[model samples]
Target: MKKDIQIPEVSNVYVSVVNEYNDIYKTHDWNAYIINDKDVALEMVLIVTRGFSEIKSTSTMRHKLDMLPAKSYAKIEFMQEDVLALNNEFKVTFFEANKMFEKTYLFRKNTINKKALQTIPLMEVRGVLVK
Candidate 1:
């Protein structure tokens, strides 16, 4: 029997999955970030429900997180040898302070964007030594 899983259409937090390559290790790295904009702490968990009856984590997929500080963010990074594992279905359940906990599903078909560690470029003063 096929299960019915719904992907969330909206969420209070912004989630972005970045595909990174480490030249040193010569392996692919995946990072997921959960950004909370509200003025409240949040508890989150990534749920992967693909080729299974319910949401679960396998050797290929894992979920990690607890509480995100108010107006702050949390990040989860993992290394996977299989690129296809990155496409697995995912969702997050957050405990909203003084409110009921909620779940948001993430629907990703392909690789997302590359994470820009430096949003703004830092300029260097060439040959300038401040005494």
Candidate 2:
């Protein structure tokens, strides 16, 4: 009976981290974004994120969106410099084609740095992407 469960595989969706300039704060900040590259829209999008290490962890954060259109992206949250040393994880769940799908993206500890950045999909800026 348990084998009957089927969770659709999530594709063309990604979570990325970007170091961007904050005009109000006059500082460079690390921000998280969710990118949907598919031709179809995603509904009931939800994201839960957290940072953790072997002995330390940050609070869990939950974010929601009514819909995420195709070929678009949305900012999830900002990360302080201190959390860069911990493993950051983003769990994304959404409904597409009348089915529910989920995927988890991770930025390993110390990996979200300028050296690891590349042109993020569907966005003009360069950033570290989890695919």
Q: Candidate 1 at residue 127, lDDT?
A: 15
Please give the distance, in angstroms, between residue 96's alpha carbon in candidate 1 and its true position after superposition: 1.2
What is candidate 2's lDDT per residue for 36-127, written digit by digit as tens?
A: 99999999999999999999999999999999999999999999999999999999999998899999999999999999989998899999
Clashing pairs in 1: none
lDDT of 2: 0.96
Model 2, position 126: C-alpha lDDT score: 96
Best by TM-score: 2
For each candidate, the alpha-carbon lDDT, in order, equals 0.46, 0.96
Quote each prediction's TM-score: 0.51, 0.98
> Residue-wise lDDT of candidate 1 within 6-38, one digit each (tens)?
333334565544455668889656555556666
